[model samples]
Target: MPLYLTALATLLLTALSLGPSFAHVLEAPPRLIVWSPELWREATVFNGQFELFARIGGPLDVAAMLAAALLTYLLAGERPAVWFALAGTCLLVLGLGAWFTLVAPVNAVLDSWTPGPIPSDFASIRLQWETGHMVVAAAKFLAFASIGIAVLGPRLP
Candidate 1:
């Protein structure tokens, strides 16, 4: 019963965390093509507006990872299910790694900018940021699917 509850929590948290990442993925196409000034303005405005998301997403991301880990532990000795749980947890970790390595640096660069001149390498930065989010979104989607399999596979015929 406790294991079932934990698996449910893990699924919910993971799905919630995936929401922002998927939103970013959807935003990337329009974002990637805008003029430099427009991009800069959007980036700055978005940075200002993203605090709420950060506040909500940060904890959810951490909780999802923790919950997935716990689910993996609980499923130990359960064949196939345990493997899926482990894969899900690993994918979440890797998604976070991609964010820190790719997205966060770009964010730091954007955050450091003032209303003055945009950087010469703004395109490169934008591409990296968008690509990073896409990668994270893919990883998170897979993680959610894997965790779903972990929880439900055993019950299915």
Candidate 2:
């Protein structure tokens, strides 16, 4: 029961932390890919706002996952601790990895960009950034599914 409570708490925190980022993802990418340079510049300012939110929000997500992992380790007696740990860890890794490797670089590029001319490689960068979002979403979905299974698996007949 304690483990279930912890997992639920973690799940809720994850959702809270990710909610802003998800909003940005849904609204930003497709339009960004199509925007003119002047519009892109304006959008970059908006993106910066979300970046700040993400910076503030991401650590909370990681902390919640850590708490979940610790709870699973300490309280999951006779339950599949390994499964919970893997899911939780995978979620952390996928989110952080995408941010650092994929999103961050493109953000840096966008940050430095001026409003006159779009860079030649901007399309490719946008593709990579969007792809990173997709990958992160998929990983998160899998992790959530795995956690659900682990939490409920032993209760089933």
Candidate 3:
């Protein structure tokens, strides 16, 4: 029962954490190609909305990582389930690593911007940010799939 609960929690948290990354990926096509001024305006406006996501998402991401780790442990001796859980946990960690290394630095720059002239390097920064999210989304999607397989795969007893 505890194993089942942990598996469910891992799946739910990982699925939820994918939301913001997926949102960024969906918006990247249009956002990436827009004029600097337009992108600046959109970025500033969109940045405000992310406060809510940050508050909710930060803990959720951490929770998902922990849950994946826990699920991996709980599934020990369960053959392919344990292997899949381990893969899912590693993918989640990889996603978080990409977020910190790729996304957070650009976020710091974006957060520091004012209403004045957009940075000359805004395009590069935008590219970094968007690409980071796409990478994160891919990692997270794979993590979710791996975790799901762990939970649903045949048990070895």
Candidate 4:
């Protein structure tokens, strides 16, 4: 049961983290830029709307994941068992932390980059930021999938 709960947590978080894949991005010829400026605006607005939803409900989801970790500890065994549960929890935590710390802010900067920008370097920086966000997002997906698979496959002990 604990393992299932852990898997559920990972599954939910993964879906949340990666579920917005098509919101603001699309495939262009060679550069991965917004295919539709209108779509970019629409997607950003939609994201803002869902963010209100997250504000109302996101913490509860996080709390559930934390609770699942403790439940695994209590329902399972001692050190080694707890360790696996902890790792599963940590993968989500670490991935989210990476998203907020390392990726999302750069995304914000890129989104705010202007036509009358400071320098050509700003565009280059925006490109780098976009690339980094994609990499970090992919890493988040990997972490999420790993957690989900681990939880599905075995108990902590």
Candidate 5:
């Protein structure tokens, strides 16, 4: 019961945290791929959008998963539940580590990237980093969503 409550709390928070990013994204001006300046701005916006899954909100997802796995462990007396918790913990730790080592520094760069008269080299790097950010964001979202469904889907009754 405690685990279920904990998972729900985390899910609610995740939903809350992601809401504004989605809102900003939807309201953003349309862009053309050929326009480098516009692309730069779009890149910046996309980078900001990536924040939800790569930051602490992501850890919340893992924590929720761990809580659910532990709940299963406690209730069912099953080895799978224990395994799931351990797996989820490891995933979260790795995700956190990757965020610190790779993504966070790039995020700082993205934050500081002013939106005027970008150099070709700067644009290239920005695009590359932006692509990487998207990849990580997708992975994190998938992890969170899968864990959520795995834990909560069955309990939806």
Candidate 6:
């Protein structure tokens, strides 16, 4: 069981970390540049990379959720194990929910954006989009960290 938990935790951690890692590389640097519709549109183009990452990472969430469920079932009657499983499951839910509600809408708009003149409302929309991504990244990082702690916390001492 410990080995199984360790393996699952590693996979979940790696999967969750990808969001922030990619965001840092792809999204963070642009904030340092002058904000413009053209700039924003260019940034939108780069977001396609993130979309690709999401397509791959999205399925891992389901695997993590199932791991939690299986852990709960296997460790039935063990309070800590059950709680950890619940925490892992809840964190996944929160992270994915934020992604869909906060990030996906922005992604849709970005996908349609062209390279020409920027839209008048681009700044406001970009702010929302960037802010939404930051929020989702934080949620995912927390979820990953929580799962790690839950799985490995006891063994530490």
Q: Would you estimate the TM-scores of all the predictions?
A: 0.91, 0.75, 0.93, 0.54, 0.53, 0.74
> Across residues 47-136, which tens digit of lDDT does each residue of candidate 5 receive?
565565446566565555455455445535434443443454344445445556655676666566665666455655555454444444
Residue 21 Cα positional deviation in candidate 5, in Å, after optimal superposition? 8.3
lDDT of 3 by residue, 1-157 (tens): 9998999999999999999889988887877666466665565445576787689888989999999999999999899999999999999999999999999999888877777676788778878888999999999999999999999989887
Tens digits of per-residue lDDT, candidate 1, 33-148, equal: 75455665566445566776679988888999999999999999898999999999999999999889998898888777666566787778778888989999999999999999
List ranges where model 2 is wrong by over 4 Å: 32-34, 45-47, 155-157
> Which 10-residue window in model 6 sums to the lowest lDDT?
148-157
User: Which candidate leads the pack in lDDT?
Assistant: 3
Candidate 5 residue pairs in clash (backbone atoms < 3 Å): none
Candidate 6 local accuracy as lDDT? 0.63
**Model 5 bad stretches (over 4 Å):** 13-35, 42-77, 111-116, 149-157
Give per-model CA RMSD: 2.1, 3.1, 1.7, 5.3, 5.8, 3.6
* Runs off by more than 4 Å, candidate 1: 34-36, 43-47, 155-157
**Candidate 3 lDDT trough over 10 residues, lowest sum:** 38-47
Residue 33, candidate 2: C-alpha displacement in angstroms: 6.0
Winner of 4 and 5 under lDDT:
4
Ranking by lDDT: 3, 1, 2, 6, 4, 5
List, residue by residue over 1-157, the lDDT tens digit for candidate 4: 7545655655675556554422212332233453344343344333464474347334643654565455456535644545555665565566456557765676566566554425445545545544544654465455555555555555543
The residue pairs that clash in candidate 2, if any, are none
lDDT against true structure, model 1: 0.87
lDDT of 2 at 4: 66
lDDT (CA) for every model shown? 0.87, 0.64, 0.88, 0.51, 0.50, 0.63
Off by over 4 Å in 4: 1-6, 21-84, 107-119, 155-157
Q: After superposition, how far is residue 114 of candidate 4 from its true place, in Å?
A: 4.4
